[model samples]
Target: MIDVTMTRAYEMMVILYALSIVLYFIDYFYKQAKIRRTAFWIVSIVWVMQTVFFLLYIMEMKRFPVLTLIEGVYFYAWLLITISIILHCIARVDLPVFFINILGFIFVTIHLFAPDQVQNPLGESAVSEMLIIHISFAILSYATFTLTFVFSVLYLILYKILKKKKFSKLWSRLPSLQQISMWINSSILIGNPLFFISILLGLEWAFMTLEGLSVIDAKIIGSFIIFVIYLIILVLHRKGKLSGLNYSWANIYTFLLVVINFFLGSKLSNFHLWY
Candidate 1:
């Protein structure tokens, strides 16, 4: 029963993916200067198609699929795809189309193969629109930090390549080190205050949604740990200790917490494990 609508959406996504891959391949193997441009326009169209299906699912289900494990993974796939395409359009990095294509394929596989089911929320209190807004902003901020982590990994790889004095193929695919560094910094600059607001709103939501003012769930504690870690980083960054390996490692730690929350700790984690 789930497959009926889900499969239809999947088919649309696969079609878009197929087009994107073909366009990327054309842009790569052919080396036609205009091919990448065309590929981008095509990817944009595909994004519109996905938007339709993504919204359709949400509307039909009457809840955000992105709140669950399977749906969250799927959303990550969509996010990465969108990020890669948008960055390509704006930055024009020499990143190998190969890796990008491979990533696309991998996400597609997960989207197609992963389970699909309506994951219900835990408590039934009608959260305020502001609370949902807080969650959205928090999730977007989370996504930015996640992207920053990816960029840090890219920087490290590029650093290694430069140290060995070999321009590995990946170097071509990535933005310049200076540019990537700035991206990481600016992203955090934006994420920090948004994160702070998110935490404040989260506290209010907890009080409003739950029965008491002091109910500390395991999830609450887990989230607090992350919140504190990030808060420390932001403060230190203000004092200027956020650079080099220290920066990368901090991102790495945050990324791990993100994975836990997005996967194992999300509402649908257990269901995904058993589905």
Candidate 2:
């Protein structure tokens, strides 16, 4: 079964991710077009392998691999690739190969090298499918935020280039300012509805099970703060009240909040972290 295979698949992905990172870094500073292509090929092949691994995990476990630190790292790598693909699609931003690979590499490195922790498959068959929906969106929101953080960092680099009038490297590689702003908007649009619905379902599920008690724990607080911040950003963006600089700042802030929620907040606040 692929669930059993996931372990092997993860190991392979780590190797590939590391190799890709090395190649990408070499390509980035050396200005070798062929090296960049080779790096992307390595990344792409591993992503496909991991994609299959992910699908198999869901099938065997009947749950998204968002639980446990290791699985979370795996999913984070997938999220980075997904975001990179999306950004690549709409903006055609030629972000340094290693810039994207770094996040993926970190995830795999942690998964492979860090101490083992038990994974919590919270989607036990007993839970209602509705509850599953809540859990699904929770992961999706977190993943989206992960993507935003990476992109925001790239945006800052591009902005600096624009400021310095050094358009050679950054201008050629990154997306236009308008495209990055739109990317921010699109990430929010995808994440916002999912966040809203997930919370509602979470509350409903808890109410049905725990007599309407929603624990005001770290997990909930983290998610709530993230949602509120994004909501405000959405409003500001819509109203044209947020400058590109401010938008980038908000993206970074929200991403930091997401990370905290994933690690610290979830540990302190919610039962959600177990999964």
- The model with the greatest lDDT is 2
Clashes of each: 4, 2
lDDT per residue as tens, model 1, 1-275: 87587678667767767776776776665566786777767667766676676788789867665544456555655666677776776767635333444565576677677766565544335535555555666666776776667777777877788889998553465677788777777767777667667767767765666554553544455566776777777677668878766776787778788667644554543221212
Q: How does each model score on TM-score?
A: 0.75, 0.83
Q: Residue by residue across 1-275, what tens digits does model 2's lDDT show? A: 95457677778878887887787667656668888777777878887887887797687666655556566677767877766555545554556335666776777677667766544444353367666677677767766666566667767878888898888852475677777767667778888778888888877776675543556666776677778889998898799998678788988988887777767875675455453
| Candidate 1 residue pairs in backbone clash | 94-172, 94-173, 95-172, 95-173
Q: Could you tell me which residue pairs clash in candidate 2?
A: 217-269, 218-269
Q: Which ten residues in a row are the worst by lDDT in model 2?
A: 117-126
Question: Against the correct fold, how does model 1 do in TM-score?
Answer: 0.75
RMSD of 1: 4.4
Q: Which lDDT values do the candidates have, in the order given?
A: 0.65, 0.71
- Report the lDDT of model 1 for residue 59: 92
